[model samples]
Target: MRKQILFLLALSLLCISFTFAQNNVQQRKIDSEFLNAVHYYENKDYDKALTGFDNVINNYPLNSKTTASYFFRIKILIGQKEFERAKDLTNYFIETYPSSRYIDEIRMLKVKLYVDDSEYFDALKEIAFLIDRTKSISYRIEAKTIGGQIAKSYLSSSDLLRLSNAFTGETVKPYLLLLLGKAFLKEGKKGDALNSFTRIIGSYPHSAEYFEAKSLIESPVSGEETSSGQALVGVLLPLKLNSAGEPTSNTAGEILDGIKYAVAKFNSGRTDKIGIVIRDTQNNEERIKQIRNEIGYNPNIKAIIGPIFSNEVRIAINDFDATGIPIISPTATDNDLTSESENFFQANPPLVIRGKIMAQYIFFVANKRLMAVLNSVDGYSPLLAATFVDEFSRLGGTIVTRQTYKSNSLSFAEQFANIAIADSVDGIYVPLAEKSDAPAILSQMVQDSMYVPLFGNQDWFFAKGFETSPELSNMLTFSSDFFIEFNSKDFQEFNNEFSNITGKDVNRNILYGYDTAKYLLTVMKNVDKNRTAIKTKMISGLTTRGYHNNISFDKHRMNRFLNIVRFKDGVFELIERFRSGSL
Candidate 1:
C-alpha cells in the first residue's frame, strides 16, 4: 500500500510541472511576438506589424503583452488615416487601463487625431480633459498650445471674453489671455487688442506665442499713430494721369473730380478731422519727380492719391523709401508694384491677383485645358496676360498661341485667324483697357469661325465697340469692378444720386470717381487737415468699404478687389468677384 501511494504522489507532481512549463512557453511566445511587432512598427512596415499584434492579441488575450498591443494598434490605425477608429481604441485603452503609464500618451494621441480630422471642437474637449487629468508638464504644455489654437478658431471677441472669465489657473490662464487679444483685434477693438498684445509681450516673452504677440505690437496699426493720437489714412491711385495718345487730355480730370469730392466731404461736416493732398505725374518720369518733391517738401500732406498710370508708379518708388507716408492708387494693375514698394498702397484690383481668379474659373470651374491670350501693348494688359500664362501653365494648361495686338491698331484678323486654326485651344484671355479693341478682335475671331470661350478685362463693360459689333454675341466671359443694370435697385439708387450730384449718366469712370471720393472722405474724417498727418493716415493701412465695394491697399498701395463679369445677350452678367488680398 505504501509503495502505490508514493507512485501516485510522483505522478501528480510530474503533471503539475508539465502544466507550469506549458504556461511559460505560451508567455514567452506572446512576449516574442509583441517585441517583433514593435520592431516592424519601428521599421514603418505597419501592415506586417499589425498582423503580428493581431496574432498576439487574438491568441494570448490574457497575456501581459495585451496592453502594449492595444497601444500599438492605435498607432497603426492613425498611420492609416483611420482617425475615428484610433480615437475609439484610445478611449478603450484609457478605460481598460486607467493606471497604465501610456494613458497620458493615449490622451495626447486622441487630441492629435481630432486635430488631423479638423474636428477642432472635439479636439478642444479632449485637450480640456487632458489638461485636467495629465500630470506631465510637457503633456500639459501641449494641451495648452492646442487649446489656444482651438479657442482662437471658434471664439469671437465676446466668446473669448466669456471663456477667459470661466477658465483660470497658471497653466490655462496665459493661453486664454492670448486668445482674448486675438479676439479683440478681430472685433476691431484696437485699444483692447493692443493692450492684450502688449501684455503677452511683457509677460510671456519665452512662450511660443511670443512672436505673434510681438508682431501685433509692431504692426503699422500699433505704431506711432496709435500713441500720438493721429489717424493715418491712405489714398492709393495711379497718378501718372496721362495715357498713350491722350497726352494733356488724360484721366487726371476724372481722378481730380474724385479727390475733390472726397475733400469736400471731409471739409464739410463730420466728427473725424483730416487733411488731403494731391500728387501729380505726367507719366512715369513726372510721377517719380512729384513723389520725391512731396516727400522732401510737403511734410503736411499726410496722404497722397494719384499716379493713375502703371509706368509712372515705378518713378514714385522713392516716396516709399521709409517716408512713412502711404500712397494709395485708385487704379494700377501691375502685380510687382505691391511687392516692390513697402509703403505703397492701392485702391484698385491688381491684374496679377485678378489673373488667379480668372485661372481658377477657367481651369477648375470651366474644366478646360488649352487657352490663348489676346494681349495688348497697354501697361496693364501685358502684365495681366503674363500672369494668366504663368498661372495657367503651372496648373497644367497648354497655351496654343499667345497673340499680341497693338493698342492703337485696327487690324487683328491675323491674330484671330491663328486662334481659329488651332482647334485644340479651349479658351481665350483678352485683357484690354481701351473700349474699341475688344469688339474688333472678337469680330475677327467670329468671322474665322472660332467658337472657343472668350475672357476679357473690366474695360469690356464700357467698350462701345461691343455695343456696335455683331461679335458681341461671341463674348463668353469677362471681369469688371462695378456694373449698372437697368432693373437693379443698387444701380438705380447709384444712378439717381450720381445724376443729381454730377448731372451726368453714371458711367464706369464716374463710379470709380464716386468710390475714390468716398474712400478719401472716410479716411479724412479720422485725420487732420495737415498734409503730413493726412499722408501718414492714408498709408497706415486704413481700409475703406465703399458703395462700389470694399477697398484696401496692398503693400504697394494697389486695390485688391475686381468683379469678374460676363457678357450675354447684349447685357453684362456678374460671374465672380476677385479680391487681391484673399487670393
Candidate 2:
C-alpha cells in the first residue's frame, strides 16, 4: 500500500514538471514573436509587425506578452488607417482582457477610431463610458471635449433633440441643450433657441453651461426695448480669411462668434442695437494696413476689437494711432502692443508684465526675499526671466543666481549645479519655452535632490509628464492669463471643440475675444460710443469678471487680472483669484 501511494505521487510530480515545461516554451515563443514584432514596427515594416503581434496575441492569449502584442497590433492597424479593423480589435481586446494593464489606452484608441470614422453615436457612447469610469483625469476631460464637439458642430438639430431626450446623464443634457440653442440660432430659429436656453436655465441651473445660457436669454418682452441710440462696435479680426479672404479655419470664426454672441446677448432685451462691423485682416499685416483707414474713419465705428495677431495689431495700431479709437487686441501678448499704441488694451498681458507680476507676487504675496532664475537664452523664457529679475530686484528682493542655458538642452545638470540653490534661495524661477522639455527638467531636478519651491509661467501648468511626477513639482507657483474651471465646463467644452475644428491649440482665444467684447461693450452703454469716450472708460479702470480672465486694465494698459496658482497634491489649485503689481 505504501509503494502504491509513492507511485501515485511520482506520477503527479512528473505530470506537473511536463506542464511547467510546456508553459515555459509557450512564454518564450510569445516573447520572441513580440520582440520581432517590436523590431518590425521600429523599422516601419508594419505588415510583418502586425502578423507577428497577431500570432502572439492569438496563439498565446494567457502569456504576459499577449497584452503588449494586442497593443502593437492595434497601433499598426491605426497607423495603416484601418480604423474599422483597429476598432474591432480594440473592442475584442477590451472584452477579452477585461483587467489588462493596456485596457484604458486601447479604449481611448477605440473612441478616437469611432470619431475618425464619423460614427458619432458610437463615439459618444464610448465617451460617455470613459468620462465617468476612466482612471485618467486627462482622458475624462478629453472625452468631455470630444463629446462637446460632436454635440456642438457635428450633430444636427434633430439628432441633438433625439440625443437630448435619450441621453439621461443630467450633466450632459444641459451641454447638449446649449449646443442645440446655438444651432437654432444659426438657423434663425430664435424661439427654439430661447426654449433650449430656457430649459438649461430652468432645469440644469447648476450645470457648467448655466451662466452662459443665463447670459444668452432673449429679451423678456416680444421685441428688443427701444433704447436711446445705436452703439456701433467695430470688430477687426482675421475672421474667415484664407490667402484670398476665404475661410481657412474656424479659429477666426470662433473669435467672431464670441463677439457676435456677446453682441446678440447684449441686444437680447435692449432696444439699442450694438452693431459690429468685422474686417478680416486674414492675419495679414498689409491687409491690416489696407483696411486701417476704411474702418478707422468710419464715424459710426466707436470701439475696435482685434486684429488678433500681435504683429497685425502692431501694424493696425500704428495706422490707427492718430484716429484715437479704442483698439483692444483680445489675444495679443506682445509687450510692444501697448507701448506703441495708447488705444490698445491687451486682454492677454504681454510676456514682460507676466514675469513682472509673478516677481511681484513672490515678493509681496509669498514674502520670498531671495530667488534663483534659470531660463533659455532666447525667445519667451529669457524675456520672461529678464522682466522678473528686474521687477524682483526693483521690489527689494535678492537674486541668489541668474542662470541661462541654451534652449532644448535636456542636460540641465550644469545649469542646476551653477544655480547652487542650497541656501537662502527662497525660490527657483525656471521659465520654460517649450512645455515638452518639462519632464527632463523635472527628472534632472529630482536627481539633484532639489526640493525648493518652483516659480514658473503658465506653460509649466500644462506640462504633460508633470501629472505623473508630482513629487518633482515640489511647491510650484505660476502665473497664467487663463484658468479653466472644471466646475464651469461649458467654455472648456468649447475649448475642445475649437481644437477639433482648427487642429491646433486655441488656448482660450474665444474667451479672450468674448471677455474683451463683453468688457468694452458694457462700457459702450454707459459712456458715449465715441472712440475717446470708450478709451477714457477703459483707462479709468472698468472691471468686468469674465469666463477665462478678469478685465481690469491698470494704468499700463495690460491685463492686471493674472491668476496666481500652485500645484498642490497633484492638482492645480488657485492660490489667488487675480493679482498684479505696478512696474
Candidate 3:
C-alpha cells in the first residue's frame, strides 16, 4: 500500500513538471511573436504585424505578452481606419482582459473609433461609461472635454440649457457661459452675450476659457440703431456653384440666409425698403466678374456684403474698388485681402493675426519659454506656422523645433518621434487643420507616456476626432475669431427665430452674415447713402458686438479681436483675448 501511494505522488510530480515546462515554452513563443510583431509595426508593415499579433493572441494564454498583442492589434486596426473591425476587437479585448492595465487605452481607442465614424452620440456614451466606471481622472477629464465638444457642436438650445444646468461649477462654468454667450450673440442679444462673457472673465479667471471671455467683452458692438434710409445693399453670395446642382463647398449660403433675416428685420423695423440685390456667383471667377458688371449697372448699390471666399473677393475687389463701393466680406480671411484694396473690410481676422495672438498667449499668458511646432504642409498651416515662429521669436520665446508633415499622411509618428521635448520645453504647437491629425500625434504621445500641454489654432477644436480622444482633447489650448456661447438666452432666441425663418440651425457663416448685415444696416442708415460715407464710418472704429465676437474693421480694414481658449478638465476654458496690434 505504501509503495503504491508513493508511486501516485511521483506520477503527480512528473505531470506538474511537464505542464510548467509547456507553459514556459508557450510564453517564450508569445514573447518572440510579440517582439517580431512590434518590429513589423516599427517598419510599417501592418499586415505582417497584424498577422504576428494575431498569432500571439490565438496561440498564447492570458499573460502580459498576450495582453500587449491584443492592444497592438487594436492599434493596427485603427491605423488602417478599419474602425468597425477595430471596435469589435476592442470589445473582445475588454471582455477578454478585464483586469489588464491597458483597458483605459482600449476604451479610449473605442471612443476614437466612434468619433472617426462621426458617431458623436455613441462616443459620448462610451466616455460617460469610462468616467462612471473607471478610477482614472485623466479619462474622466477627457469625458468632460468630449461632452463639452458635443455641447459646442451639436446640442440644441434645450439640450445646451439642460447641460448648462447640470454642470454649473467653476469646472464647467466657463464653458456653460461661453455656450450661453454664443446663443445670445446668435440671437442678436449683445447684452446677454456681454453678460455671459463677463461672468466667465470675472468669476473664473483661472478657467481655461477666460481668454475668450475677455475677448468677447472687447468685441466692438455699435449699439447704434438703424435709422431710416434708402440704400441698395448688394448681397454677393455663392448660393449654388457645384456641377451636381448642389451648393459648392465655398458658397456662403448660411451667410446669405443671415442676410435675408437681417433684411427682413430691417424692413420690419423701418419704413424704408432697403433693397437687397442678391446675386449668385457660382463661386466661379468669371461669374464673379459678371456679378461685378451686373453691380456696375445698378449704381445705387452702395455697400456690398460677401463674396465670401478670399479668392472670390480677389476676383471682384478691383471692380468694387474702382467704383468706390465698399465691400465688407463677412468670411474672406486672407491676410493680404485688405492689402489688395482699401475699400475691403474683412469680418474675420487674417491668419497672420491669429498666429501672432497664439504666440503671445503661449509666451505671456501660459508663461512657456520653449515650444515645439508640428505644422501641416498645406492649407493655412504653413502660413500660420511661419507667423507664429516669427512672432514668438519677436516676443522673446524660442522654438525648440519645427517639424513639417504632408497634410494627407495617416500618421505623425515620424514627426512626434523626432521632436525632443526636454524638460525645458513648455508646450507643443500643432497647426494641423484636420481632427484626424490631432488623434494620431496625441495617441502616440499618450502611449509613450509623454504628458505635455498642447497649443493650436481654431482647427483643433473643430477636428472630427477631437470629441473622442481624451488625452488629445484635454491637453489642447487654441485661439479663434469666433466663440459662441451656444446656450445663452440670446442664442436660444436667435436660434428659434433663425430656424423659424430658414427652417435650419445657424452656422458660423450665418452669424457672420447676420452681424455683417446688421452692421451694414445700422451704419448705412445713419450715414449718407453713398459708398465713401459707409467706408469712412466702418474704418473709423465702427464696432458692433455679437454673441462672442466684436465685428469691427481696424484702420487697415482687418477684423479685430480674437478669443484665446484652452482645454482643461474637459472644457475649452477661456484664457484671454488677442486683439490686433497687441503683443
Candidate 4:
C-alpha cells in the first residue's frame, strides 16, 4: 500500500509539471509575437505589424499582453486610414481593460485621427472629455492646442460658445476664450468679443492668453491693420448673420475663403501684404448704409471689392462716390451702376452690354449684316433686345424687324410673321429669361421657317436639345459673362492651390471672389497704396487673366469682355472672345 501511494503521488507531480511547462511555452510565444509586432511598428512595417498584433489579440484576449496588442493594432489601423475599425477596437479595449495603462494615450491619439478624417465635431467632443477628465499634463496640453485651432479657425460662433462652455478649469478656459474673442472681433461684434477678452484680463492674469487679451482690450476696431507694409481694402458682403452670429450663406463664406486665399498668395514672395476690412452688408439697404457710415474716411481702406447685387451697388455709391474710393462688384449686372458712380467698377458686364456683345459677335465674328429681334416684355429680354437693336444698327447692320410678345406666352405668330417677311435677315435674337421658354420659341421659329442663325443671351446655356440637334448646334451663337476651360492646366493648378489654401473645393461663388480679388490685388500690388491711385489703375484697362475669364474695367468703368460660345460636333466650344484688347 505504501509503494502504491508513492508511485501515484509521483505520477500526479509529473502531470502537474507538464501542464505548467506547456502553459509557459504558450506564454513565451505570445510574448515573442507581441515583441515582434512592436519591432515591426518601430520599423514602420505597419502591415506585418498589424497581423502580428492581431494574432496576439485574438489568441490571448484575457492575457496581460493583449492590452498592449490592442494598442498597437489600433495604431496600425489609424495608419492605414481604417478609421472605423480603429475606433471600434479602441472602444472595445477601453471597455475591456478600463484601467489599462494605454487608455489615455490611445484616446488622445483618436482626437487627431478624427480631425484628419474631417470629423471635426466628433474630434471636438473627444477633446472636451480630455480637457475635463485627463490627469496627464501632456494629454491636456495637446487637447488645448488642437481645441484652440478648431475654435479659432473651424468652428462657428455658436460652436465656439459651446466649446468654450465645455472647458472648466480657469487655465484651460482662457485659451479658448481668447480664440473666441478674436473670432467675434473679426465678425465686428466688439461687445460680445470684449466680454471674453475682459474675463481673461480680470480673472486670469497669469494665464497664457492674458497679455494678448490686454492688447486686444486696448486695440482699435478689427481690420484697421494698415500698419506700415500692408494695404487695406474694404469688403461689403451679403453675409447675413443669424442670431447666433453664424453666417447664413455658404456662398458668402466660400467667397470670403477665396478672397483670403488671394490675399495670402499675394503676400507670398513679397514683403508687402494686403489687408481686408470686411463688413456685412446683409444684402440690406440699412446694412449697406451702416457699413458706409462706419467706413468714414478711414484712410486705411484703399478700395472695395463687393456688394453683390446691382441695387446694392446703387446704395453703396451713395457713400463711396464721396470718398473717391473705387467699388468693384463681381456679380451685379445692372446696366447703369457704373454711370451712377465713377468710383464704382463693375467686374461683371452690365445687362446692356451682354446684348451689345452678342450683336458685335453676330456682325463681326459670324460676318452677318442684317438681324431681327423677338423678345419678351418682362425681365432682361427687353433691355437685351433694345441694346442689340441699337448696337447692331450702330455697327451698320440693318435690323430686319424688332417685335415683342408677352413674357412666357407661346404665341409668336405676329413677331415671326414680321421677321419672316423681312428681306435678307442674317439672324434672329431671341432673349428669354426663362430657359423653359426656349423649346417653345425654337419649335415656333423652326415651324415658321425663320431659322437663319440664332443669337441668344447667357440664359440659354441651361436650355437642353440645342447641343443635341446638330442643325441648331451649328446655327446658334451666344455671349456670356464668363467661361471656364475646365481641363486647362492653369485652372487645374488654381483649383489645387485653392483647395490647399482654403480646405474646401472651388465652386463658382469662390471663383468669382477669387478672380475679383486676384484682379484687384494684381492692380494694387504695383500702384501707390492709395484710393486715387488704385481707382486710376483699375479703370485704365488693366487686364489680367482669371480662373474663368479675364477682368478689365474700361473707360466706361464696366467689364466689357464677353465669351462667345458655339456648339459644334455635339459639344460646346469657346470660339471667340470680344474685348477691346488682345487676349
Can you write out model 2's per-residue Cα lDDT over 181-228, one digit (the tens) per residue? Answer: 866766677889899989998998776566557655733211222223
Candidate order by lDDT, highest to lowest?
Answer: 4, 2, 3, 1
Candidate 1's C-alpha lDDT? 0.66
Clashes of each: 52, 2, 32, 0
What's the lDDT for residue 75 in model 2? 89
User: What TM-score do all the candidates reach, one by one?
Assistant: 0.46, 0.56, 0.54, 0.59
Candidate with more favorable, higher lDDT: 1 or 2: 2
* lDDT pick, better of 2 and 4: 4
Score each candidate by Cα lDDT: 0.66, 0.76, 0.75, 0.78
lDDT of 1 at 534: 52
Alpha carbon lDDT at 71, candidate 4: 84
User: Using TM-score as the measure, which candidate wins?
Assistant: 4
Q: How do the residues 1-583 of candidate 4 rate in per-residue lDDT, one tens digit apiece?
A: 9999999999999999999998899899999998998999999999989899889988764687888888888888888889899888877876777677787787777777788888777777677766666677667766766776666567766776787887778666777787778778777888989999899888888775676677567653473443343578888888887899777888877777778788888888887778898888888875675476456345567889898877787888864575678898888988778778888888888887878778777877788898888888888889999888888888889988888888667677777888878868878888887787777777777677665788888787787756334676578778877787777787788888777766777887887888899999999877788777788898788888876567887678878688888766766677766773321
lDDT of 3 at 92: 86
Deviating ranges (above 4 Å) for candidate 3? 1-229, 241-251, 271-273, 285-287, 297-299, 407-422, 464-472, 568-578
RMSD of each: 19.0, 19.8, 24.8, 20.8
lDDT of 2 at 366: 87
Which is the winner by TM-score between candidate 1 and candidate 3? 3
